[model samples]
Target: MIHPLNFDSLLFGYPVGKINVDQSWDEQGFLEEAKTFQLVYIFSQSELKYSSETVRLVDIKATFFKRLDQSADGCSSLERPNGELDQRLVKLAFESGAYSRFKVDERLDNEEFEKLYRLWIQKAWENREILSLPEKEGMVTVSIDGDSGKIGLLAVHPDSRGKGWGKKLVKAAEMQAKREGAQGLYIPTQLDNLPACHLYQSTGYTLSQKEYIYHYWRN
Candidate 1:
């Protein structure tokens, strides 16, 4: 059934929608539908594998979490940030490592991307736990699905990259999950984001799975 896909699309109208399926999904059926709809996302997932890799859980009293400041984030992205769409973040997502695997036409333009981010941002805030590290100059959003803590968004300023802010926020997310009593934390990223993937591994996130994200557009 396409029920899962429908739910994701309804939540935020993300120009590109994503759905995760394990080995049990109808592979041949999906391929057949791919011929009818535009397959915009594709990736694979794996169980997180690691040994004795523990992240240093640290939370400073000086650090705190707050609501998202769309205005501030928009300014960082550009002068006029669209209130309707989180376009600023969408543009940065363009640099994603997995994007190279996509067909050019499958990608959404800025306007459409903004709609997607807008929907995701709203949902992340409404249902998930979202945090911003002002001290470290970064942002991260997380959600708990079943026993896992899922990180929805993680971003740091370009100027803040090498200073360990990314890892800090990642560690913070881990701590957040622990406080909520999750068994483990799950973070998804593309291959092109070597730095991010490395940060996760170093911070103790094992390679759980690498999957393809394929999107279908009915037009």
Candidate 2:
């Protein structure tokens, strides 16, 4: 049995003792390994499946891709909007923008949220760009891999939702991707996040695939 790092913090119960592995491994062999540990958890991302006594599907994720047709005037990371709001509120809004749905995100403590904020801000500054409205309504950070022009981390404030701010941010991301000569853009969203999925689809992103997250464990 192999012990893998849980970067996404998927360990549900025992963060320190639990271990996550691929679903394709020998189940019985791994089950035997679990007997040696205090308690173990096997977590994986796959297509939807029926839950069993040992294996249970936990979360569903959807993938989307976009192909830019024409060149769009792109913006840089330095062009972030200065909403002039309270710093704490801005931080909260940005942190919650793209990650509120992920189960792991819900586990983030104050320190973790701060780390994520700094990490995301740094990533945008180093390699990607941010599209922001600077208002109480709009806030997002889009990370782009310059070599591949893959756009990532699209976020919008909940208050800014339903007013087309997300669509606008996506458009900005697409333009930036095209400017960077990327093939297109790709993003994965939770199946339950209907508005986000809808915004991506409405912005010319096509459904790429469906995936699920499962956690198998025993006491």
Candidate 3:
């Protein structure tokens, strides 16, 4: 079945929908149903070999999870911003999504991607939930629900790539989650983004699951 994605439609100025189907789904039937929407996103547990019409956007999304040490103290170096959003943070947020499906789909307008990330950083900052290094060279956002936590957006400046800022940001997120009484934290990155995968693995996160994401555009 196809579900209309109202937010996506509004963001992209076109009809957008999503389909959640297993490997057993009939390809012809799925394509026929998907044609109703201008763009349809299909998510599956296993990689799907589809006709040329369907574009495999993200090969594998590897989600890494780590159990927090509630006894450990949270990081004190990260600070929450006050007042207007920082343009630097906006750029960092955009950099963080370089491997996102939106960026991978060449059909999508590049300006839209920038606008999307701009709004993302703006909202995260306005919500006052964003954390950043004292130097403001990187930032990370975390969302908590009961005993669980998830890192939303993480990015380090291009000039500071190899300086271990990303790892520090991850550690800060863990500490923030622990302070909020979260027992564990989860973060997802595209499998092809080896740098991110390596960073998470080195920071004590383990692979939790892998999924396939495909984009079907009906022009």
lDDT of 3 by residue, 107-208 (tens): 776466787888888888887769997777889998888999999899988878898788888988898888888899999889988999999999889999
Q: What is the lDDT of residue 162 in candidate 3?
A: 93
TM-scores vs. true structure, each candidate: 0.58, 0.65, 0.94
Top model by lDDT, which number? 3
Which residue ranges in model 3 land beyond 4 Å of their true spot?
A: 71-75
Backbone clashes in each candidate structure, one number apiece? 20, 0, 0
Which wins on lDDT, candidate 1 or candidate 3? 3
Instruction: Put down candidate 2 lDDT per residue, 52-155, tens digits, no spaces.
Output: 45555545668898766775544333245443434543463454544333234333333444554555555554442655555534445555466345445565
Best by TM-score: 3
Clashing pairs in 2: none
For each candidate, the alpha-carbon lDDT, in order, equals 0.48, 0.55, 0.84
**If both were scored by TM-score, which would come out higher, candidate 1 or candidate 2?**
2
Model 1 RMSD in Å is 11.9
